[model samples]
Target: MQDRMTPAERLAAVLMGQKPDRVPVNPFILGFAAKIVNLPIGDLYADPRKSFRAQLLCAEMYGYDATPMYAYASFGAWEFGGEVGMPYEPGQSAPYIIRHPVESPEDVDKLEVPDPRKAGSIPIAMEIAKLCYENKMPVVFQAGEVLTTAANIAEPARLLRWMIRAPDVVHKLNKKVAEFFIAVAEYFTSTFGADKCMAFTGGPVESNKLINPRQFGEFVFPYMKQIHSKVLGMGVHVILEHPCSDQNANLPYYVQLRKELGWNGKYIWAFGPETPLEKQIECFGEHDIIMGNVDPPSFQFKSFEDVLALCKDNIERGIKNPSGYILGVGCELPPLAPPINVYALMKAAREYGRYQ
Candidate 1:
């Protein structure tokens, strides 16, 4: 079955709640893109121009159906006056926080919200957004999830301990992070016009594997609701929420947050493989688009056939979703993943993800 629509058309159709000729493939590729273009992975995070160019090249080569965008998991550290080390080595995929800003409770009180346009990676991200706008693609921006960004600033261990020992301090830090993300939402939407921007963020630190449901409810849910609600209220139509790992236990809270925000049919939830695809659909299939659950490491360590098999299974299941589905990796496409294995996603979309 030949594709009846271009990649953009296919995605547009899905966004509008209509079926296209086939499922769109948007594997959560990032550092892997730099590798494909023979650039060091560090360039993907440290240099916005290089990152966007590599991503565009890789997407064209793979014939995938997603626009190039920039973000790293360790988002808050550098933006809030901490330091980060870029991915300079072969195995390193993203910049890591080298120095956390809030080393003590006093630091949290002293923390100030930096200008979104000039702070840490926001400048880099703005450059990418400009390129995307120039190229007539959606201008995407990262709006940090409250807990994850706060954890980055305070250091995860200290943040978690603070949740128990100094609950007030934790809330204060989260409040500040929320302020930063709200400011980011305001800046991006104002710069690009909310109608033209897509806001995205993930919750790796708030994953159920590390924190239980009660903790997520207490620490993660309220702030996330505030940030996303503000983003949507600002006229940003779509938000991509990637709950990065084992968040099955946290699904109810997410569903509740989505409801309170009234983001029905205007959100995309991309789950990590640790959260079953069935569960994702069960939670959000009535309205939002469901993407992912493909194991990222399989693209690096498994055979092409095995990778395709995984894609096939996900597509078969996800295609049944009422809202829509996209073929994608649960997390960042590993930098070392074989090109053939990455291509397997597109192949699976073509072979088994057809609508007619």
Candidate 2:
């Protein structure tokens, strides 16, 4: 699509609270981008060459306003002693966690902050960051956040148990996890620029659905706040990914997080389809960036028409915000998401998402 600004320029303008030609659309296609080129998703991840090319190809195919880097799942865990073993299969878009590093509460104490430069996927991810900078692809990466990384490194059950029975142990582990991601945030901001880098986490982050506000206050808040302060200080933007559903119950905590963090709303917060459109619009629409919320997994079952209709509904709801919005699937697209459905998404975005 022709634009008054380059994709990078449009992203920058919108982020600075200026109008771009239209709202940005960056679905989290990740390894699914490889499928469009018929490469095994495994190689696309492990091999930098394939991963880079596939990411660019997918952006071109979909005409996304910005591209995404897959600093995906377990890269931090593997570096900090988790066993990462899902070899990408032809049909598989992502590797799975064969083994996690920490099995018990005590294991969390043994965790060390790996050197960000030498850590698990940091080298590959660094290479990806370099490529993006050189090519000027406006992009974002998902490194592990403190709370999620704690769960990743240690079993969630064990981590949560410690949060209740032994809160000190949980804090100790979170400190290490926060340190690792803070280094990662610094790396990206230093390599590229703050405007070009976004640090994202929170599929299960302190969601009221998973834990109570008191638990959030006790266990999750401090570490996450530390991580947020450090990363934002390093000049990178931070995104607290889908803080949890049941906004009535959980949204206010997120609201408090933004205000307390003094974001005055520079930070971005994403929400999933499970979150109500009105609530997101009311809470985040005017104050902060909201990237999000089309469901990727449901694409396969729905017809192209249905998917487009849903995208129409989703975009219409999202664009009401003055803070700016990016249309996207909240997380990675399912591996087998149909090409037609993917096309429908891009088409729907362009047709329905144009600015007035």
Candidate 3:
């Protein structure tokens, strides 16, 4: 225990597949923090000040090495000058999206990517990033893939349908969306310092579970690569990448995408809850850091023992990876997850994730 690294050093060292005192306990806590802090979900997402405090509280409470950004994925909608409808949920923070801005190919032609520094939530997101950097808390400043952002403003179904029926329109829209994220990534890396800044540049739209390789190749992959390359070019080594929920089947394609683009950047790919752990270790062991797929929703019902086992199970397999691994929730932990589960998880990591 005396020889173990601090949380910051642990994450950095393990990411390079170097020795860490123990496996880093960096779960993706978002709404979970809001819920525990008693802040209304929508309010926290609206104000970066509250968001920053909530994240600080989470790091203090769970001893997490980092905070996952974006409890609501509507920043792109806000930046694009699209309307967002906020609806209340029965037990949790409001997850909101108003309407699709790009209802037709004609709309794509009108889409304008704004400057990140002045864009809607982009400035607010930067404030939060700066706070995290200043406090020495690692965090993802720009999150959600270009596809998720584009889909939020353009509508998901519409984006997918146009992929087949109106491919040209999709390309136009993706290029603009990708360009916007590149600017945001550049700003974050340059302002906060690349080592402290990270962003999730991959998600559902390109996953094999949701879209076939051919479809992704045609509609999403190129823009994702462009954004990925530009983000790395800014000297941000640890880029956060992922597939949508339960889309681990697309893992191989992600590796291929990185190779094809000659991405020489360090990366962190969060494994989905349903993504096979064994397979994740087998495939990602060579080059990147793999975070776990701990399903956050289950923590609502699962006993402390259940959460403990889940953490231990993942740690056992994750620590076997030759590259690097970190314990992470499958997605954002919901408001109802038992607070005890947080302790249960960290306990498992501390005890089992030790580098014997």
- Report the lDDT tens digits of candidate 1 across residue range 217-321: 999888888888888889888888899888888989988987787654388888899888888888888899998679988999999999999999999999988
On lDDT, the leading prediction is 1
Rank by lDDT, descending?
1, 3, 2
What is the clash count of model 3? 1
Runs of candidate 1 with Cα error greater than 4 angstroms are none
Score candidate 1 by TM-score against the native. 0.98
Task: Indicate the worst ten consecutive residues by lDDT in candidate 3.
Answer: 86-95
lDDT string, candidate 3, 1-83, tens digits: 23356677888788667968878877777777777888776656767888889877877777767754653555577678776
Better of 2 and 3 by lDDT: 3
Task: Please give the lDDT score for candidate 3.
Answer: 0.73
Per-residue alpha-carbon lDDT of candidate 2 for residues 77-177, written as tens digits (9 for 90 to 100): 57786667545654555666667888766676666778878876677777777787788764465544566677767767777777878888888887887
Task: For model 2, give the RMSD to the true fold.
Answer: 2.4
Between prediction 1 and prediction 2, which has the larger lDDT? Answer: 1
Tell me the lDDT of model 1 at 232: 83
Q: Which window of ten consecutive residues has the lowest lDDT sum in model 1?
A: 258-267
